[model samples]
Target: MKKITFLLVVFLALFSCQKTDSEETNPLLNAVLYMQQSAEYKALTLQIYNNAAIHLERALADKNWTAATEQNGDYQNLPPAVILDVDETVLDNSAYEAQLINSGRSYTSESFAAWCKEARAGIVPGALKFCTAARKKGVTIFYVTNRGNAQKEDTRKNLRRLGFPLEKEIETILPRTDSSDKGKRRAEIAKRFRILLLIGDNAGDCFSGFTHASQVKRDSLVRVYQSHWGSKWIILPNPSYGDWESALFDYNYKLPQSEKLKIKRSRLVE
Candidate 1:
């Protein structure tokens, strides 16, 4: 946590004399700091995972209890599995965001891809314990991530190093092969395994129709499926970045930083 804050301080100090406008406007600085430094962030993640543990037991006892909206047919007879989004849910990649801040740049595919390939991400708070306990109870763990297929091995290695369960006989790491939306992948998993829980940091991780949706629409969808939250679906705090952030900018990745910040500020309330 100190490391994250130190990086930001050094970045700002390095430019204190020159002080370019861009240097003063890194939006990710505080978010990354909170993710790294705050006891509240750690507490929230631990609380969510602790809730997930309770729900997992309930789902196991009641065979009819399935988390995925994608689950259908006679899934009770199938093997049980928990589907989790990789980044921010199980893995903490705030270091990568810190790197972006230090470099005075926004996220780019190339930079993120390189970071993933490094396989140096720390596990999210309580993720290792939750996943290990779930695996011990004979629930198969499936990582349904949007990371590109090219990074699959590195992701698997990272998870393995962190003591997360990985089935040798089963290909559990499902990375993005076609589209970024994960609905199809979840549906495919549902066909084979009774999904006991859907855990992630993004709304899109648990349900479809959230990608690229407007802020109001996303909030409405949350209400539309209000019952599922903390029951069938568990969400981790990820204010640092997600579709929630993109929705503020209307999913316009090409928008200038100033424009994006303008849109975000306009949405704020007293």
Candidate 2:
């Protein structure tokens, strides 16, 4: 009788430990793991960049192949350029995301700024090769990131350390100043150069309407510009974080993590 009681207690304790372990799991574990470890992720990034190279060759052959919607009127004679986003586009910041997971905290501007200042981010797969090839072909590479102007220097250091091309005579790293609408920055680039491609991980990187847009509205815009996905606008996969995740919670970053998780879970199809 005592042996049976001891066995029952042991089983209950083991079950309790399992339950606690399951509840304590970090939500970002799988996403970060995929980005850091998966061969499939590497393959996908390589494929996207290879496709971009092919399309770039095509765009260079033609003078009128302007990628930005902001580029209008007599741009055929302008020097060719390519605009790309920094975070998760050219430089991989998954290490920062991994830090957040380990620390059991949500994202904060202060923390992200600290990370940027370190300028230790790894390069995204195939980005270095692609950028180098494009620069060699005489295409001016511009990084139009929404990272605040304060991060511009550190961002440049990171890019330079990674051996990506940077033109000393021109401002290649155009960080956000007064607006997060990247279209204005693209327009600034368009003033002097013919943009051959716009590459990034977010929809806003490709066009201007995606800022703070809802999921439904974002999908609508994606359909509206369906023709540009693989060719003129190349997007790298970013499941860890982006406007897509924020759109699920209605862009309410202030919401408690639990509430945001609940809303995200509710959106999942059964």
* Highest lDDT against the true fold, candidate: 2
Q: What digit string (tens of lDDT, one per residue) describes model 2 on residues 129-164?
A: 999999999999999998999999999999999999
* Regions more than 4 Å wrong, model 2: 1-25
Q: Clashing pairs in model 1?
A: none
CA lDDT for candidate 2 = 0.93
Best by TM-score: 2
Listing every candidate in turn, what is its Cα RMSD in Å to the true structure after a full C-alpha superposition?
Answer: 6.9, 2.5
Per-residue CA lDDT of candidate 1, range 22-78, in tens? 655577877899999999999999999999999999999998998888888999889
Clash pairs (backbone) in predicted model 2: none
lDDT of 1 at 178: 78
- The per-model lDDT (C-alpha) reads 0.92, 0.93
